[model samples]
Every structure is written in structure tokens, then in C-alpha cells.
Target: MTRWRFAQGVAALAAVLLLVALWAGAPEAPEAPIEALPIADVVSERLTTLGSVVGLAGSGDSHAWLGIPFAAPPAGELRWRPPRRPEPWTDTFDALAYGSPCVQLASGFGGVSDQDPGSFAGDEDCLYLNIWSPRFDAAEVPTGDDRMPVMVWIHGGGNTIGYAGSFYEGSLLATRHRVVVVSVNYRLGALGWLAHPALLAGAEEGEPKSGNFGTLDLIAALGWVGENIEFFGGDPDSVTIFGESAGGKNVLSLLASPMAAGLFHRAIVQSGAVDTVSLASAVNYTDEEPPGDSFSAKEVVLRLLIRDGSASDRASARFFAEGLEDSEIAAYLRRKTAEEILSAYRDEPDSADIRPPRVIRDGVVLPHRRLLDLFAEPGAFRGVPIILGSNRDEIKLFLSQDPAWVSRSLGVVTRVRDGARYNFVSGMHSDLWKVWGVDEPAAALSRSQEAGVYAYRFDWDEEPVRMGTDLGMLLGAAHGLEIPFVFGHFRFGDEATAKLIFDEADEPGRRFISDAMMSYWAEFAYAGTPGRGRSGGLPEWSAWGSDVGQFLVFDTAADGGIRMSTDTLSTQGLLARLEGDTNLDQTEKCELYRDLFEGSADWNQATYSGLGDRGCPPESLNTARSD
Candidate 1:
């Protein structure tokens, strides 16, 4: 290991050794006091938000506190309702290990949630947030000048499943960028976001009666941060919101949500878009079936559950009481298994009334329809600066076929026993469809408020994730690949492409790029622009659409990383097919377009789930070759 890496190892070892005394009420060691090492200092702390917050404060120019619950557990009767303020406690709650992730089916989530095999399990009490704030310099204090910018994070799992523990560590960004960082967890799956007519009718003032309940949880956390971050020495007004994948989508949602206005000043969205759920769907929220012929969130859950096994009151009761343990719940779950319990819920009387009918046009929270449509209409948000990009091989996580089959499968087509034929595939999978909009994020942002937009493409993957094949070979900086580079985490890309994906020339490569990222992010937080007027030796990035075809490629290759095009986005084409003016509604349109999807005779659904045309067609002025 390099000297810095060795230092890291030693620091971690020391941290492990020191954690014993940091535990609340634990005895301090009797060893003689030694001078502080190069490592940062962290301490345990209890903060009061909706409830008593047990948090840890790490030292540096900044400090971080981990795992503070922002909302009440979604247990029992509260399962489908919007999250409430966690019940207050008289004692300090221990914010030690990241709390359990909310209970989710784990069907679609891959990278956004914990990718670790041995740590962090998904649970009911998963509505917590983690905070990282740079130290307040005495100069910035009221009498002392002590203040730094803050950036809060919201993890993404399609408003279903994700946690605050993985894929993000605010230390590097916090101290290096001289800013505060925060990551949070929210409700997910059937428990976190279930919008029903009955629930809507019961909506009280200040509560999100319909549409997005999980979104409300995020708002509450922001509110909590606004109130408490000052205690940790952060500037409350100059906050930025950022995340990757689903978390990016959450940030955008917050931007439009009335409840989230003024909570953040700047934003960074890595691979998130608005065209995810078509505006057409049906539900069984009431006694009878919903009045549409389209597939709805509620209907999808009901059918999936019934198919999964929820067939009667016992099953229904089990599914409803899933993870709801004042006591005995864990035993029941252990006895039945998660699948069996979920199956039982499906078998219930109104399983169809479970989740959101659809992420419909909520004028209050979303403030607009079709994410880009609002940009077209203008005034969708506070018009803050945004740093948005996607990985070159973002589709890597979606590589489903065993690696052994990759080479042969690349250009050839085959028919399976299910009478399904696989075509030459390229891109992500259906599960990705569960969370991300198929539209290229670049295309989506082109039509949005475009002033502060910064875009990038991630194209790196180090090791192959395929259990049976070198699937990574096919994924060139696939989805979310740019994240590590942006955050200065280089392990996310391919060993072959690392230098190309990021500046890998030396320690300065990591430090410089990280510095650039931090400065730009901090600059955005400070003054709606990156770098705080300092270039950080990085190239300038420009906005897209309406001509001026300019972009800053993030690759380290001496290609100047500059490209321009206004014709790569075919969002209109994709939307037209997904939700068109035809008499057919979106689901019907999709059903009709089924011939063009995965198992169809001519198309490759596994990797390339797009219109026959790719992004950025030179022939079209409004599209690009990448689109």
C-alpha cells in the first residue's frame, strides 16, 4: 500500500481500538495519553430532532454525526401513511451502526442500497440521516469567522429501498472541499410510499395526502437539518443537495416539492431524469377496481403479491404486520420467511390498494408534469446551479446474463425455452426501469432550466461483477460509474479505463480531481456557480440544447474531453412512444409497443432498451449521437 493508504489502514485500526471508549457510558482506557495522530477526531453525540438523536462527531476542519432518525418507524398502522415525526425520547438514542434499511422486496435495488454482502440488512426503523460538517473556523463565527457550506444527501431506491451507510463517505468531500455533507435514509417499498384514495381522503393539512409520502420524509429530514445543523457549526442557508441514481431523482423531487423549497441552494444529479413513470396507470384504492385499463402502482403490487402468495386473511395479516414488532414480529418473520409473509399480503382482500397508483402529477410536491415539461413551461424550481452527469457504463449493474455467455451473446441472437429470443443487447435491464427513466439523463436536463447544468458521462469499471463471465467488458463506465470519479473514489471504474475515466497520473490526479469536484460543488453552494470563481485547473463545462453544443468530457485522456451536440436527445420520441397522443394510454401504448421490447423478434431488450435510434442522431438538430 502507498504511504497514504498505510496511514488509512492505521487510522482505521486506531478507530476500531478507540470505538470502545466512545460508546456511551463505556470506560476510557487507562493508557497514558498520547498526542493526536494525523487522523481526524470523532466523538459520540446525542441530538434531538423528531426524537433523541444518538450521533457521532468526528473531528477535522469538519465533523460528522451518523445515523440520526428523522421520522417514526413505519410499523403497524403507520405502514402506508406518510412518515410522522419520530416520537420524542427523554434519553439520548445511540446513533452508532447505521440503522437497518427499511423492509423492501430487494427485487430492483442493486447498487443504490448496500452492495456489501456481509453488512447492513434492510428493516422497518430505517428513517435515519447521517451528517458531516466541516469545522467552523473562528473567523467565520459571529464573533469568529466560522462557517462552511453544507450538502445533504438523500439515497435513492426508487422511493422504495435504500440506506445511508453505503457508497457515500463525506469525509474526503467534507474536509477537502471545506463543506459539510449529510446522507439520509427514508421509507421505501410498500411501507414508505403507498398512495391510495382512502388515504388521500383522510389527508389532513400539512400532510402529503396523495402521490409521494416518502418524499415527505425527506422534507422532514431537511427541516431537521435546518434546525439542528447550526449546533454542529454549519451554515444553514448555503446547503446543496446531491446524490447518485435514485438519490439524484430524490434531489430533483425535493427541488420541486413545496415542502422542500429553500432547503437547498444548489444540486448535483448524477443520472436521474423525469420521464420515469408514464402518467397513465390504474389502482384499486377503493372497494372496486380503479377506472383505467392501464397498469398502476397499486395494481402492480396487488398482482405481484398475489402471485407471490398473499391469498387470504392470514397472508394479508402477515404482510400487513411484516416487521411490525413491538414484540413477536421477529419470531413470526423467522418462522415464515420474508417471501412467505409477502406472499400472504398478496393474498389479502385489497392487496391492490397497497402502493402508489402512480407517481402522478402532484402540483404541490412535483410542481409540474414530465420533468422536462416543467422546464419547457419554465419556473419549475428556484433555478439553482446543478451538476448533473451519468456513467459511460452505467448499465453495468444491469448485466444479468452470466459472463460466460457474454462473448457469444454480444452480436448473436438466440431463442430460449420460454419462446423468447435474445437479440444483440446493449445497456441496462428491466430492474433499472424500476427506478431510472429510460431517457438519457442528458436529454432530460437539456429541456430543463439549463443555466447551471453541468453534465458528464462515466465510462469505467475495474473488476467484472458477472459471476460467470467478464460482463464488465461490455459495460464502459456503465450507470453510476462516474460517481467514484466525481467523489474521487477511483475503484468504481475498469483498471483499463481508470486513467481515461479520471485523472490517474498520480496522487495529484485523485487530489486534483477531488479538489475540482469539491471546489465546484462548494462554489455552487456558495454562489450558484462552481469553483467559487477558481478553476481548479479543470476545463469549463457548458449547458446543452438550443444549439452551442458544448460539453466537458471527464476522461483523463488528452482529448480535451470536449464534445458538442444538440441532436443526441430523442426524449420527445421516447415520450411519444411511452405516453402519446394516440387513443392508447401509456400502459396500453407500452403493451402495444411490447413488440419492440426485450424478447421481441428484432429488438434487444436486455442491454439496449431504446428507440431504434440511438441518442444524438446527427440528422436531427434536437438530438445527439449518444441519445
Candidate 2:
């Protein structure tokens, strides 16, 4: 779109929005006394740190500060380095439009991809953040007596895709919950993650030299929020960090990172699993890929050099790779454009094959131990109140998109019927998530901080998917289904997916679930306990403990809405039930056990041994195990 047309669109949107703000009794931008000067057309506000005004545009009840820079653009020589503070400007900087997402693949491969219309297809200078607040006018800015809670959202795209702007519109949470919502944009793909000896050559002696530049970007945004949110009428001391999927995993990382202490007061993880790699694994290319090498920063640099005709053969490439000085290699790597480095990982046939471990166990930012091990240690976490949970059918999103890939990833080659495959995949991922992602971590946190950890399961399956089959049956409570509900954004993304996932038929359940979630999440941000100050008749959510693995199940049932339940359906207990069911022959039982749990990391050796004593057939179990 042309600049003229874009400006016209902005004016039209702002004009329509003004009517809503007026109806909502939102204050006009102040003017008169210099301190009370109000912004016009698109409502705007000035932050305390920069003292530069930013225009707000979006739906009326709230003002949106889109594409606000938190750090200097990490491009050119700054490509692989930690974010530097953005340069201050003397004049108002227009934050009227959404910023481009960090450079990433256009489609889903390793994780969910952001395909929004203005994800502007991707860029290198994407360290921007967006905010949605109910009060943005100078007159509405809060004084010492009345400050709103702040929620900083980290969007999930497997740490490879997604941006801060369009997909995660925060109006509903801001308006309905009376909180300030900030969604952040961080670096993605190889540009955000490539750590090498050369890349860290000139680093300060004792600093973190790991590749998790994406994690650093997030830390920078949090630092920015803690400093400037008060200018937007948000209480900086009451900040809550929340995310889903990869974003959720990031929340876990922040909790475990020593550098992140005091940045956020609360954290919530939804379907987030943590995986860390050692510096040895990242730089060595020891795992398998093409040419008998792992997909790492070394391979990416080699590809760029070969593509540019700097080195014609693998031998010469190896010569420069191993023989060159660390500073020399760092300089050469920094000189390459963002695209040249990212192109190496962009060509895999499927996302499943190429998802190399990205979060590293660097000593400075992250500890050397695995995340789960760290969670188990006393006081290892930031000692903050936390909420963690998963969907009932987390794997359905993957199965619906590509069953073959889902099956392979699930480690199943059984020729079971489609219905059975669906049941197996969904049940397997859901149970495993509860065991590892939710319950275990909650149990650990509970031991450290009593009544400080909460767990939940989103089971609302009334999505109005327009696909041929009933969406409730096909998608169920799938991965990311909880996100739109949390944000109260029933319509998601560009076109058909929104209509398919939520339509008139799904309004009642959507409204009910969204209201409850917003109330629960926002209340936690306010009082550090969900049930403390809520007047909305929300269910009393209990905390999870080692012995008591309680969770608030979010579903729209005929009898009651949200209810607290115990962990009766433990992974081992569920497998035992499948084994003891007389209706299923030995073949089905063994196949179900092996397909659903055997090869998974969540598998319990003790439970498997008990099942063997329960007369599960040796042959069927053996066959499924062989693959």
C-alpha cells in the first residue's frame, strides 16, 4: 500500500475510534498547561524516559501504542549482539502502525508461524513493543493513588515466527480487566539464535556468551517496561509476564534466569516446555543434519560463505571455519546480511526435522543445569507467584494440520484407524504436558512457595471451525485455543481461521470462558493470588502442592462454568485403566500403551514394569517398541 493510502486508512480508523472513546467517557487528550498538553486525531501520550509523544490508534475503549521501540535496531554489525538502548529523539515519534516481525520463515515448520497481513513479511530491526491501555490521555494518566496493573505478553511462534502487533490485540484484556497490556516483539529464527566462538570473541570476560539473543531481546523489553510503564498509567511494580507455547517456555526461562530477577513480579506459562542445549552441542554440529552435520550457527556461516563464492569447497570452508581466529570469524559472520544467515534453516521439508535446541545453558544468563533440574532446587526460581497449565487436546492442532508429521513426532507407525490415531495423539500430548509441563513444575514451585503456584486446564471445545467435520470433535481444546480466550479476541488473524474457530454459534461459551480467564489472570496480577480481590463470582482457585495437584478446569458445562479438580487422571493411572479395560483385546491395549507413552520423555519406567506384571502381551508391546 502507498503512503498516501496508508495515511488515509489511519485517519479513517482514528475518526471511527473517536466516537467510541467519547461514548466510553474516555478523557480528551489534555491541553492548556504545558504538563497537560493533549495529543490530537489519533490520541497520543508521552513517556517519562524519552519525553517523546507516540500516537495511539485502534478500537476506541483503549489506546494502542504500536511499534514503540524498546531497543536500538539490531541490524548490520549489531545483528548478533545484545540489544543496546534505543537512541532518544527530541520530537514525537509516531507509533501509529504495527512494526514488522523479526526475520523468520513465512510458514509453520518448527512452531506456529505469524501469517498476519502486516507481519510485513519479516525484518531485522524488530525490537519493538506494542501496548494497549484503557487510559492513555494526559488527563487519564494515573497519579500516585490509582495505578493499573501491567501485563507484558510474549507471543509464541516457536521462537522462530510471530511479532508483537496485530495477532495479539490486547484491547479486551485492557478494557475488561482495567489493566495495561504490553505485547512484545523479539528476534526470531537464526538471526535471534546463532551463538559461535567468533560471535562472542570481544565480549566482556565474565558475561554470558550463549546464542539466546532472542531471550536477551525479551529481557531488554522488560527493562524498558519497568522504566517507562508508569508514564502510561500502569504500575511498573505490578508487572505480570505471560506467554503461550514458545512464549510460555520463555516465561519459564525468565523465571530461571538470574539476570531476570526483579524484572517481573508474576509469571504464567501455558503449554510451555523447556529444552536447553549446552554450548558444546550448539557450536559443534555434533547431531545429524545434511552432510553429516547438525543445523547450527557454524553450518549457517558456511552456507553463507559458499553461497557468496568466498570458499568453493567444504575443505576450504572447514579451513576458514576451524583455522581462522575467533575475532576474524566474528567479523566475517557479522558482515553477512540477516537473510544470508537465515537462509540456511529456511529450506527444510518439515518443521519437525529442523527444530534444533536454541535456548542454551550459558552460565551468566541461564544456569548450566536443565530447566527442570533448576526448578527443583530451592529458591532457584524468582520466588514469584506463578500459574502454569495446558489444553485438553494440545496435539490436535498439530494432528489437524498434518497427521503424518504428528504421528511421526509422537513416535508411532501403527496402522490404527484415523479415529484411534486422533485419540492416541491428543491423549498422549495432553497427559504428557500435564505430567511434565504443568504438574511437575507446579509441584516443585509449591514446595518452595506454598499457595504461590496455580495450575489450570482449558477444556472449552465449542470452537465453530468451518472445516467439514465438527470443530469440537476435530480440534477440541487444541494448542493455542486458550490464547484467544485469554485475550477475549474471538476473531483471530486475517480471514477464514477466525470465522472457523469462532462464530455466532460459539459466542456464549467464548464470552463465559473469556470473562473467567481475564478475571482470574488480572486478579492475580493485582493481589498475587487469583481469589483475593475478585468480585465477579469466579471459582475459588486452589494452589498446587506436591501431594495435592489441583487445577481449575476451564470449560462451559451445563451444570457449572469453572471448577477446581484434583489430579485423578494421573499418567500412570490412565495407562492402567486402558490396560485393564476388558473390551480392548491385548493387541489394542499394548498398542495404545506403546503408541501413547512408551517412547515419550514423560514415560515412567516403573509404571511400564508394573504394566508388564499386569499381563500386557509381550509380542504387541515388543512390536510397537521396536519402531
Candidate 3:
């Protein structure tokens, strides 16, 4: 079978087994509306350490400072270097509109744009942040013990796309929780993560030589918060950093980073994993004796050379690139435009699907040790309160779009072809995600740290079935479905898209869950723990213990409400269960095993090969390694 068809079949089979217990039934009736703070005009000006900033009106009783520059533009000579602080302004900076999103291929899912998907948009001068806070007098900046807690958000798009734009507006979160919210923009794609020996030749001796520039940009934003947050009524000492998906991965990178020490007191990682590329893989060519990634820096340069007519073919390009000195190579790469650099890695001219390695293990910005090892090692990571979680049906979001499992009508509405298989496979992948992203880290951190290490599983799946589209089964508590609940903002994409997932019939439950999540998140930011939420009248969220697997289950009253669960998962247990399963044939079982090995950080070749006659071909393993 072709790789694409094999992938679909595996997804279908794997998803069938995991959806037995998680999906909740439809609610009986609409409940009471959730009570919220009154909306009123508030102060919108603040004087930062750099200069004055004038903000604009926001939703409810909140003020929004949009597009406030935290760092100088990382353009031209600054492209791959660490971010620098913006120059002090003489005039009051007009923080009324959002800054341009960092350069990325536009898509329906990430970044801000009206442009068609796969088209290029955004700008390199995108080192800016947006802030939201409850209304207060301009002269009365909260100080000392009275300052509000600060929560900085990092948007997620595989660390390749997304920005601090309208979809992630913090006004509702800020005004509702009576706290300060900040969202930042960072460099992305090849510009943000390329690592090569040539590029490091002229670099400074410290973290600048490390090619984890996107990670550094986040650290720089946190540094800005430390110096200037008090003017916005936010306490720097009580700062919390939170993100979803790629943003969550960035948070994990920060936790593992020695450079980010004491910058933020708490962290929340949602559906994120620990991953980084080796220096050899970052700099080598894919066709070399010891092959590197397809998008390695040397390979990218060769592609650029061919694209620009500097060479006629791959062999000539390789000969030319290798003959050049490190300085010459660096200078040549630095001279290319952002579009030119990005075009070298495009799989399709009209598809934003490039997947280059990110978050390099450069030993300076991010330590050389594995992330889980750092967590287990005392004094390696900041032992602050942290929450790690994943959605119960995370993989459904992606699988629902796959033609092998789901079919769509009118190019919008969708339906699952085989609900049993789809649910089972999605569940397995989602469970594995939880194991990799949430459980493993929580277990490691809880064993080492004195500070609270909490865990959660989002299980709110109450979408109404429109026409024949079973959104409850199709979307469920899928990836990124919890983001709106966390922020209490349900507006995503256009009106029809929003309505398809979030129905008016489920408004009360949606509001209920969103309020609880916000309270728990805000309370965690205020104190070290989320005990009984901010109101001190919800279910007590116990910390993850070293012995038992404990985590709060977030759902509506109809679906068991907010409660605690002790069901923890591990790779060994999952593999054993897969081995014993009678539902899948030998080929299907091997396909699932292949996916598991491919997705895992701790790959055990012996264990995989021990699957006996059910094992995949040895060549498949080699292909996986090369890719």
C-alpha cells in the first residue's frame, strides 16, 4: 500500500479502541447563564520604563494595549540572531493596533490573514506583544502587594505559524478574571530555528550562537514583563506563562532552559511535548554519507542555490556550497529575502506544509540533556507550580479531516465514515499524546519538585448534531478545543465554523465549563495551587502524587461535572494492551505499532522488534529513522 493509504488505515484502526468511555451524552436542558463582572470604561494609558503607551478600548471593563514592541525587528542582519530590546521612544507609542504577525505561510488554522491558504503573509518586524487588563485609573497603577497576577500567553502552530491576534484576544480573560493578560509574537519557521556551523562563525560567545532564536524571543518577552509589567498593574514576581500545542512545547523548552530561570514563576503546558533537533541533523545534508533531515540547513542552502540559478543541479550545488568558506556561506544566506528563504523548503507552492526541525539542543539556550532528565535532576529546572494536560479526544480534530475516516458535505459539514474505528484510533493517539506530553513530565516533575505539579484531562464534548454531521463524535474534546474554554472566548474562524462546533443548545454547559477552567487557571496564577478555584467553592484539585496518577477531569454537570480521576497511562502498558487486542489483524497491529514508535521520544528498538511475526519490515524502521 502507498504510505498515505497505510497511514489512513492505521489511524482508522487505532482510533476505534480508545473512545469507549470518554464521549459524553447530550445534555437534557439549557442551564442558568453564568454570572460575570459588569462591563464599563476604564483607564487605557501607561508609562513603561521605555516610554508612554496609549491603548484602546476592549470588551467589557477592560483596556487593551495592542502591538507594543518588546524587541527590535529581527530583520535583515538580525534575522537569525537573538532579539534586542527596542529603542526608547520619544513620543507616546501608539499601541492601538496589533503589530504584523511574524513572517509565515498563511493558513486557515494559524496566523492572522484574509489571504488564501498557503500564500505568504506577515512581516519580519513582528517582535511585539498585546496586553489586556481590568479597568483602572491611569494615575493609579497597582503596585507593591496590590498588583494583579500576570499571565503571558504563547500561541501554538507547530512553532511555525500563529500570532498574538484577534482569535487570542485576552480582553475577556483579563476582565473576567480581574488579571493582566499578555500575548506575544515570535519569529517562526526557518528564520526562527535554522542552525548551522557557518551561521555560528560570526556569532557572539554566549546564547546568541545557539540557534533556538524563537525560544530566546519568548525569554526576551518574559524579561520585558519583569521590567515593565508593574506599570500595567501586573506583578512581575507572580507571572505565569501558559501556551497550547507548539506554544506548550515552547513552554517546556523554557522550563528546560537555564537562560529562562526565574523569568516566570509558573507554567502551563497544553497538549505539548519535549522535542529538539541535534546539531548534526541541523547542519548536514540529506544525501550525505550519514544523512541529515530533508530540510537541514545545508540542504536548504543547496535548494536556494538551485532556485536562484546559482547552480544547475544538486551535484553542482553541493560542490559549490562545500567549496565556499563558512563566512561566505553565512553572507550568502543572510543576503536572501525572507520569501526566498521560505520558498526553499516549500513542499508545494500553494501549501503551508513544510516541517523542518525546531528547538535545537545548542547547550546554551536549551541544555544538552533530555527535557525529562532535566526535570528529574534537582536544581536543573525551576521548581515552580506547573499544570500539564491534553484533551481526551485530541486526535479526532485531525482525523475528522482525513478522507479515509471522515466524509464531508458542501465542503464544510463532516461525518465519520466508521464511527467505531475512528473513535478507537483517535482515542489511542490522544491517549499516547497524554502519555508523552502530560503524564511523563508530571510523573518526573512530581518525583523531584516540592512545588505542586498538577495534571488535567479536558473531556467536554457537547456539540449538537447539525444535519447528519455528528460534531460530538467528529470534533469531541479534540486538540485545541480546550483553548476557548480556558479563555472564555468561543469565537473562532467565521460564524458557520463557530456554530458547527459550538451550538446555542449547549451554551449553558459551555459557559459553565469555561468559567470553571478560567477560575482554576487564574487562581493558579494568583497562588501556587488551584485549590477550589478563585471563589474557593469548586472541587478541590489535588496535585499529582509520586505514587498514584491523579488529575482533575474538566467537564459539564451533565457529563459528571468537574471531578478528579486517577487513570494514568504509560508506554509499556499501552503497548501491552495493543499486543493483546483481538480487534486488529496482524498487519493493522503492526501499523499501529509503527505509529507509536514514530511518535514516541523514548524509542525502544528491541521492544518493537520483539513483536514477533506481527512486526513490520526492517526497512520500515530505516525509513522512519531517515525521515
Candidate 4:
């Protein structure tokens, strides 16, 4: 299509949206029963243009109307803009095959090819949501009854990756827990988050005026659920928001955002709850100084636009902005191709754009400037029940990405980038040094004190033989590994739990861990504790505080109860010395420091565990021999 024609088309689309959104989300009918199943007990059949698919598993009884459109296809002029509710669909749209994933570079193989499986089938017109519930198993609920709680899930992808497809589906959770499961697809990477000043201007007044369009899209998705979920046998009154990795990062942001208040009742943050690790990845990215410490989303958008198409032409951007009225924006975007629009809104974000990822603190979502303050405020959040935990060796996967680690698993020169690498090895020394001197723990403990906190550290690595290599040697309790154990759904494709990432001694290894994890997850979702069903007769856990940092420790041994480390206190004390202001730990800034340049690779001879036991810094092992 010619540029002028595209421009005209876009102008028309935007005009229509303004009128519609002003009147969107009117009340809808209670869902009707669609289908039933033994595995799920109940299913709601839905038909979309793509085809027919059924919504299964609500809190015992579920009501479904399939083919619901969450947002207008982010086509043509609407390409780089914030999402809009679809101009009401006129026909029975199919809801079976998940719509294409949002377009972007595929996930990193990182030598774990079979394990990662990267992303598949994506496009710009990808704004859809799926919901499930155990309640669907029941045909009816008494009127005026708020029986089931709701959970809206946002998958993790470093702000640029992840999928909403059923392959990573959460139906089992719905069937088992009898809660509403809502999984959604939002814009990712440059398309989803790049924030330019132009975007800042277009935002409406009084209703979440800001720059990060991707974050707002999620807000829009929740807005839809808040108004429509009750019809599907859900209780909007009490909702628990949850996710792992990048998803958990978002849970913190939503908890802080005033707009998200009254939208959820409880939350679950797994494998990632504290700040600093990826704290830079969250919200409040309004830093406009000469390339400051925090990331600036607005800068990324402009740079991407310039690199791709006519974004460099300030005049064209202004033209694009002016024409954003009526249905022109959405219509024009739909008519033009994704590749075509990609040019003006480029890809391959430069270094600056990539750093400022998911869950940014734009003051609106996270009013408290820092992590501790956000948690400290009583009125900031409703202080709901929370499930937060991590894997024992969360970084072990990356450490194993070294050549020696791969050689053991494959029994050959595998695809690792370098030879003989480990997180506590030479190349990883820099990251190791940073952790030793950091002190964000006190702030995190503060959050625990403010809310109902449940914590755990997963440490499961089985041994034996596999491909002539001990898989157990490759990992401990690394990031994202806890997910499968919780659901007992380890094998994603052909690879089983034992084969995918481990060399199990026997099949019992997978079964034992799976059973334990699945039970824990179900019990938590059911009753808010890992031992919710009263099956395991274990010690009662007391919530944590700035003073008492009690936490659950899941180990290879079944009876691996609680583990405490005084090291945490020392770490907190050291933090009292960096370059920030906080009662938590404010360090004085010094112009000169000892050994400013430490050879990272020096730690090849020392292990983190070895250093801790030998009266050395638990982190010094990240460097070379230090000789």
C-alpha cells in the first residue's frame, strides 16, 4: 500500500476507537455450559474465526463464551501504538489454535536446545487471552455467590520474549484448584515496550497517562476481566495474581500500581520476588538524564523508529500522530503488513533499550521510589497472602553453559560458548563481585514483614548416567526449574524430566520430585501454604521480617526442612555502606576503594561453597584464585 493511503486509513481507524472505548465493557450475560470432560469434569465450548475450542476447568462449574476479542488487531497505523479493544467482532470467531505469538527474535538456545524449545508462530495481530477453572466442573452456583477467585497470568520473557500458547498452558491448575485462569498475549520487545515522547503525548489524561505502552496493555487486559469475569463463574472480588521469572517481577509492579488495586486479592511470586537481581527490569523508567543508571523506554522507541523507517523524520512522526483519529489508526494498521510497519518501528533494540525490561516503576504503578518503601506502605497494597520462593542454584544453569559442563552432559565438545566455565569461574567473576557487596536483602525482608509471606528454596538434582554424563553435575536448583515440579508436568515435548535436564538414577527420581512439587503447588493455590492439604506433617512456618529471615528449604532429601544463614545479616550490614539513601542500608560514596580492578577469572580454583566454609566471602569464589 502507498504511504499516503496507509496514513489515511490509519487516521480513520483511530477516530472510531475514541468513540468506542468511551462506552466499552458494558455488563454481559452469565456464561452457559458448553462441554464436559473427565480430566477436567467441565468445559465451555467456544467458537472464533480460527476454529472451535472449549474452555475447561473452573472452580467446579464454569460458564464460557468463546472467541472473546481482547484488543483490536494492532495492525497498520495501530502497529506501534497502545492496544485497543477490538471493534466488536460480528461473527463466531474461532478460539482453538492460539493466535500467532507477537513477533521478535527467538529465545536463546544457550546450548539447552531441547530444554528451551524457544518460541513459535507469532505475529503483530496477537492480543488474545485464555481462561480455565475447576469451578467449570460444576454446572451451577447459587446466585449472588462469589465462590471462585480469579488469577490473571502474564508470562515471562525478559520483556521481549515468552508465549501465551497452550503448549505452556495452565489448564491443569484450573482443573485442580477450581480457580479462573486468564493468560494473555501482549506486545513484546520494541513493539510492546519502546517508549517515545510521541507515545507520551497520545496517552489520555487522568486515566493512566504514561509512556510504556506494553504495561498499559496489561492494564487494559485486567480492566476487561474486572468488568467481565463474573459471567464466567469467577469472583472478581477476590483475585490472586501470579507468575514465575519475569512473571513474578510483574506481580511486584501490579501490587504497587494504584490502577491495579481492587483488581486482585492475592499474589504468587516464584523464583523471583526481591529487587536488584532484575530490579532494573521493573517500572519507573522515567530517567531522562544523559544516559543515567536506570533505563529509559522512551529513548528506545525513538531510536528503533529511526533505524527502521521514517522515524528519523520528525515531521512524519508528527504526521502519524495527527492522523490518529476515528478508525483510521486501527484500520490502516490492519491493512498494512507487519514487516511494512516494522520498518518505521524497527527491531534489534540497541543495548540501551534492552536493559529497561518488564515491570518499570513509572511512579504511577510504583509510587514508592524504592523497593523497601513500596512494601513498607500499608495503604500501598491491601497486604494479601503471598507465596514467594526460589531455586537453590538459580544461576547454575548459566554456569553450566560453560564448555566443561556441556562436555559432561553430551560426552563431547558440546555447544557451550567457552571451555571450562562455571558461575564461580573466571569469566563469571564480575557478577560474583557485585553480589558480595550488594545489600537489597533487608528491603526484601521488610516486605515479608508487611504481608503474609511464604518462602522456599528448591534444591533437587538427581544423579546417575545419561549420554555418559552426570546431568546432576550440570545443575542444582536453577531458575525456572521449580515450575515443572509444581505441576509435575516436566516434559514439555518428547524429552522427559530425567532426559530433558537430568541424568536420573531411576524413574523414582522424577516421580518423587514431581509428586512433592505438584502437591505443594496445589496445596498453596488451594489453601495458601505449601502444605495446605495437611498431607505432610511438617513444622509450622512463621512469616519472615527484617529481624527473622525464616525460609523453607526443599532439598534432595525429603526431610530437608528449614535452613537459616547468618551470612544474610552480614550481607545486609555491608549494604549499609553503597551509594543510595535508605534506612534499610545507606552506604557512603567513596572516591577510592581497595583493588578497584579484580581479575574475575581468578576464581577458577575456588567454589562459592568452598569460600563460605573457609571463612572467605561467599562471593569471592566467583573470581579466579585471587593470587
TM-score of each: 0.65, 0.82, 0.91, 0.66
Clash pairs for candidate 3: 14-424, 14-425, 15-423, 15-424, 15-425, 15-426, 16-424, 16-425, 17-424
Worst 10 residues of 2 by lDDT: 2-11
lDDT of each: 0.48, 0.69, 0.79, 0.46
In candidate 2, list every pair of residues with a backbone clash: 30-38, 109-351
Cα-based lDDT at residue 56, candidate 2: 60
- Please count the clashing residue pairs in each candidate, in the order shown: 68, 2, 9, 65
Best candidate per TM-score, number? 3
lDDT of 3 by residue, 1-627 (tens): 111121111112112212211232223234446956433233666889899888877888888888999999998887788899899998888788889999877765445446765577889999999999987789777789999999999998776678888878889889887889999999988888988778877686663687788888999999999999999999999999999888988999998888998999999998887766666677789876566777888888899999899999989999999899988998899899888887777777655545644688778788777787789877877788999999999777677757778764444434688777777777777898899789999999999899999999999999877655667898788778888888888866434345446777999999988999999999999997999999898999999998887999999988999999999999888888777766677777677777666534556676666664556555445324421
Over the stretch 451-561, how does candidate 1's per-residue lDDT look in tens digits? 556555443334332223232353344554445555545542123233222333334434544455566666676666653324445555456444433344444333333
**TM-score of model 4 (CA atoms):** 0.66
Ranking by TM-score: 3, 2, 4, 1
Q: Best candidate per lDDT, number? A: 3
**Model 2, range 1-627, lDDT digits (tens) per residue?**
111111011112122122223333445544435554324334456655865757565576788788888999988777788888898888778777777778764543212233432122478888999888884567768867588999999987667666675668898789877899999988886777777778877666654666788899999999999999888888989999999877888899988888889999999898887656665556664433322225666766676677788789756777667778888888887777665555556444333212423577767678878887788778766679999999888766545544342222233221213665467546765676677678777877888764388989988888542323445755678777788788877545433335444678768877888888888999998888887225548779888867778999898865356898895356766676665555556555555566566534545555554563354544433221110
Query: Among all windows of ten consecutive residues in candidate 4, which has the lowest summed lDDT?
Result: 1-10
Q: Give residue 456's error in model 4 in angstroms.
A: 1.3
Using lDDT as the yardstick, the better of models 3 and 4 is 3
Against the true structure, candidate 2 has what lDDT? 0.69
lDDT of 1 at 619: 23
User: How many pairs of residues in model 3 come into backbone collision?
Assistant: 9
